[model samples]
Target: MSSIKEKLSKPFASLVAKRIEKWARNPEKTQQKVFRNLINSATDTSFGKDHNFKKISTYEEFKSNVPIRDYEDLRPYVERVVNGEDNVLWKGKPLYFAKTSGTTSGAKYIPITKESMPTHVKAARNAILMYIHETGNTQFVDGKMIFLQGSPILEENNGIKLGRLSGIVAHYVPKYLQKNRMPSFETNCIEDWETKVEAIIDETLREDMTIISGIPSWVQMYFEKLIERTDKKVGEIFKNFSLFIFGGVNYEPYRAKFENLIGRKVDSIELYPASEGFFAFQDKQDEKGMLLQLKSGIFYEFVEADKFYDENPERITIKDVKLEVNYVMIISSTAGLWAYNIGDTVQFTSLKPYRVIVSGRIKHFISAFGEHVIGKEVEQAFNEATENTSITVNEFTVAPQINPNNGLPYHEWFIEFENLPENEAKFIKDLDNSLQQQNSYYYDLIAGKVLQPLKLTKIKKDGFQNYMKSIGKLGGQNKIPRLSNDRKIADKLYELQLTK
Candidate 1:
């Protein structure tokens, strides 16, 4: 009976893959179908009678009619549904709520519906497949897969319930397949972050793991713990590990340090995952990324950042979406969310359906001193500065501060250098010049006599991790805020900035 069920499900999975591949190549058409399906599903689940949300009928209509609803708008709806209101936007009882620490806002509890589970699983699967295909490891299924995920126990109703998403997925993953897996959530160490790290370390040491998955910072911290616990180098222990799959945060900042620790150039796969939906994954091993499965039970919408607030907002259909254009992602899923603005920015690399990249977040931009700097701009500046200078920065953070002497604002950069140069002044000037050339607003602010001069501070090794730990958010989804815009937050970050 079990074998029969497996056989029946196998064909559906294959069909999903084929359709995804096709939709990836022609996203516009797939999006149209997805949108129609979303409206139908949402109507069926919420209203009980089929009704057209006029604003969302066409891509342009969706943009014009449905206002971009942020986390705040959805919070009330989530609360209502959780309180046992029938005929809510979401049909089923939320399996779990994924907890994400908000940057400007406080903590966010995103509802995870059963219909949304397939999206996460498929995206993860696609990412793994892409890594294997890229590395020519077709027999990846033969080895044990290790996942460093969140705690699986949720404190609820004066007792403990299995963690919603993590616990639910743990329950569903096939027993035969899961028998060969090692997960951080499977252990009894669920109370403290340190305990979890120690448990993960102990498990990794015991297993002959091939593929390792987690956020880069935590993984690096774990490697550091391993080094401290034993005389064995990270490279030696991770030598047998073939693939390193990472997501949730930027890895570019810590690239070189991570490579040095691993001993060899590590093969990595990036994923764009969230509680709302798994969204996209790196599909082809060689190419940067491919949109894996946008049509798998969820409908996607993109609003032009410039016109998101317009009276008649303009929305880009999957066909209308262009390459290299940054768009705010809106999703309508089986979870009953309608034109939900997720606050994420994405750029398409190709016209084909699945050729898109998760650029960054809308709110992550830094205009601390009115320079309007963003993650891509900062990354470009770092690349340009490093190209001409001898200093190699492993990780960095930029905070805008008021110069007490001049009563003007200036950018204070905290950088971890790989090799220190004798002429520190010259290196700082080069880096400043790179930023000035790359960012027009920054250049004008610095050279055009708008703000105080740019300052560079050299930080000690593992300084960022230590600083992040100080905030009680050391591992997992926590990251060094690339740009500090808030005055109070910037003040705190300014104090953490290391000099010399």
Candidate 2:
């Protein structure tokens, strides 16, 4: 660690420690304060005035005034802001628009305002600092940290600079740490995942890296590339590498793979960051959930996930939330998003400290024949089915195949394997039985002859990676939707594999 960084770490960690202490004392109280701040900050803006923000003194009043909305519902204000209008959403024009892909909708440009910086950027910093403070592991900060990020080259939409959220965050990397950051600016702007990763391998192969962070899949790809280039394990390549920060996908399925690749057990932290806001982070080593952000320039609400699809869904505040209930998340943030449905569903694992486990997206699921299956359930099924097998699924996606031969519809899984089981048929059958065990609705459908047994389609090696690369949707902040009700993702994979 540099002398300057060593001097700075203690104080920074102390500050985060204090903040975490305050957050733990009374999350509900802190959230109400956050709600008030958000309302006051935007009261004079167009959206605020339209929603009568100034009159909303309490959470109940705020909920009463602002109805639930999605990106499309706020398009008019966003369009005005894009045309360089001031105070349409936030108090002034956004610093940038964080572009991200939507499941059913196309690309969305979320406004990133000055007020959102603390929540989006600072909260991320706090997650790291708090972890270091709690664990007393400051050695990782003493050395380099390789954050595999997206292209830094942003596109200009009217007067608004637009690009991936990771790129925007990269622009804000603390100057002190920039000296140890990996992948040169040129490599980061290369625009192709495969080529950029190769560039990254060349630049970071010999760096004294101790901390690494990014989407798990992309980082895995980088590790594979590094091993291919150096012909050495990751532990040997960067002997000091000790911390990994991951988000954008569940890390459970990839945990064993990552540990084996590193050839060592490294500390890991999970983050729940969206273009909308940074919501949670793994605060304790043994905790099963990430601590929810209560005072991060965002007011949050939760609607029961099953009820969210209804015409009139029930929106509940943090104070009224119960543990173990799957709820779709809603947020009113500093970026001018009011009662916006972020599409994520989370279950509160710990209410006293306000920790949650993300279940799935409101739109990302398979329910083609009344057999609703979510990302969490799908992940659990995979974990269960492959528990004692040699099968290691690297990446997978499921889509419904309706009437393949003028017969009943069934879910078709497209999977890429790192290790294929000796008996593929038994593996498939086990997977089918597991899903049925997890979701009784799926089981009933099969028994009632409404849907056939699940089908497995083994994808060629690196097929998911190739598909992601082909669509320009590879790397940071991008994830393949695992369970789509329709065949959009599945059809693309089929076409890509057919051509190959």
Candidate 3:
């Protein structure tokens, strides 16, 4: 760790930590200020003007003025912005278009305005700052930090640059940290994720890598590779690597596997970031949920998850939220996303400072027999089933087997195990029991004989990785859905000969 940079990080992190406290203590006031600012900034823009933003003074008025919109609903304005139109969504043309692959929508281009870009960067920076403030760990700042992300290389659409959000974030790394960052620019530009990861290992295998940040699944691939090449745990390869920062998907499913790969426990910080806006981050080491970011130029609105598909589901702001209720998170941000549904659901773990855990995605659930099993429920079941066992899961996904050969239909789990458990039947029984307990609807269905218990299909080691590679989504922000409503991914996984 560098002497000068390490010294500077603590004070700066402390300042950001204090600032977070102020906004967190006054969440309602902070959100209101953000709401007003966003509305005012976009008032002159095409979308704002269309929605009567100038006249929308309160949440009720704003709600009535602009209805909730997904990417398709907001595509018209985004299209105008893409074609080099000024004042289309935000005050001016977006600084960049964060392009993401969508399931039904195809490619989605989320705007990143000049005013909103800093918020993304600051939120990420503050996540670390918050970690440092809470743990007094500044030793990580001086060593090399690497974020396994998409190619930093970008393309131009009209006058605006377009690329993956992580790639875009790559371009904005602090100047001071430039020398401390790893995976040379040339290496990062490698389009193939596997190749990029190899190059990254070649460059960083012996460095004092202190802060390793990436999606847990992808990072797992990297760690697995390091172990293969060096025959040592990742912690041994990079002795100073202390902080593990992750986002995109919940880390619980991979927690045991990661700890096994690392050979020791390491502190981790979870972030709730998306192309639309940087929403929240783990603010305290001991906290269960990330501190919801209210002062980041984004006003949050949440609709009850059960009522999300209703014709007129109620959208409540931060002040009306309650603990442990799943909500489809909505936002009106400075980036010109008005009442936008980001598709992820959240549950508040703390109401005092408004902390939230990303519960699951709205569309990523299985309701084959009215069980309505969500990602969180399945994960909880998996964790509970494997709690004290030597078995560690590498990756897993769930789908309904509606047409089993000769029996009642059942939920099928495709799992890649790091270490297979003894007494396979017992493991399946425990998993089924845990899942039934976690979800009452699922329990009812099981007891009623409407559906059989969940069946676990063990896949070959690295099967998930192979499946991702086959689908051209090996890494770089792409995550396998924990559970799905349909058999699209399930069919593919089955076809790949990944099953044991």
* Top of the candidates by TM-score: 3
Task: Give per-model TM-scores.
Answer: 0.86, 0.94, 0.98
In the range 1-500, model 3's lDDT, one tens digit per residue, is 35887788888888988888888899888888888888888888888888898898988999898999999999988999998899988887889999999889789999999999999999998999888888888988888999999998899978899999999999999998899998889999999988888999999998999999999999999999999999999988888889999999989888989998998899999999999999999988887999888988888999999899899999998889999899999998888899999999999999988999998999999998888888889888888888899889889999999999979999999998889988889989998999899889999999999999888888887788888899788999999999999999888888886655
The predicted structure with the larger TM-score, 1 or 3, is: 3
Q: How many clashes in each structure?
A: 6, 1, 0
Which ten contiguous residues of candidate 2 have the minimum total lDDT? 1-10
For model 2, residues 1-500, the per-residue Cα lDDT tens digits are: 35767677878898887978887788777887888788888899999889898788887787788889888998888889888889888898898999887655787889998889657878788888888788877777768888888788898877779998889888988887888887788888888778888988888888898988999999999998898888888988999998999998998878767877888899999999988989999888898899998888888899998788788788888888999888999998988899999889998999878899998888888888888789888887788777866677678888999869867788898888888779878887888888999888999999899888888888898888888888877776678877888888888889888322
Candidates by lDDT, descending order: 3, 2, 1
**TM-score, cand. 1 vs. native:** 0.86
Q: Say what the RMSD of model 1 is.
A: 4.5
Best candidate according to lDDT = 3
Q: Candidate 1: what lDDT?
A: 0.66
Candidate 2's displacement at residue 391, Å, is 2.6
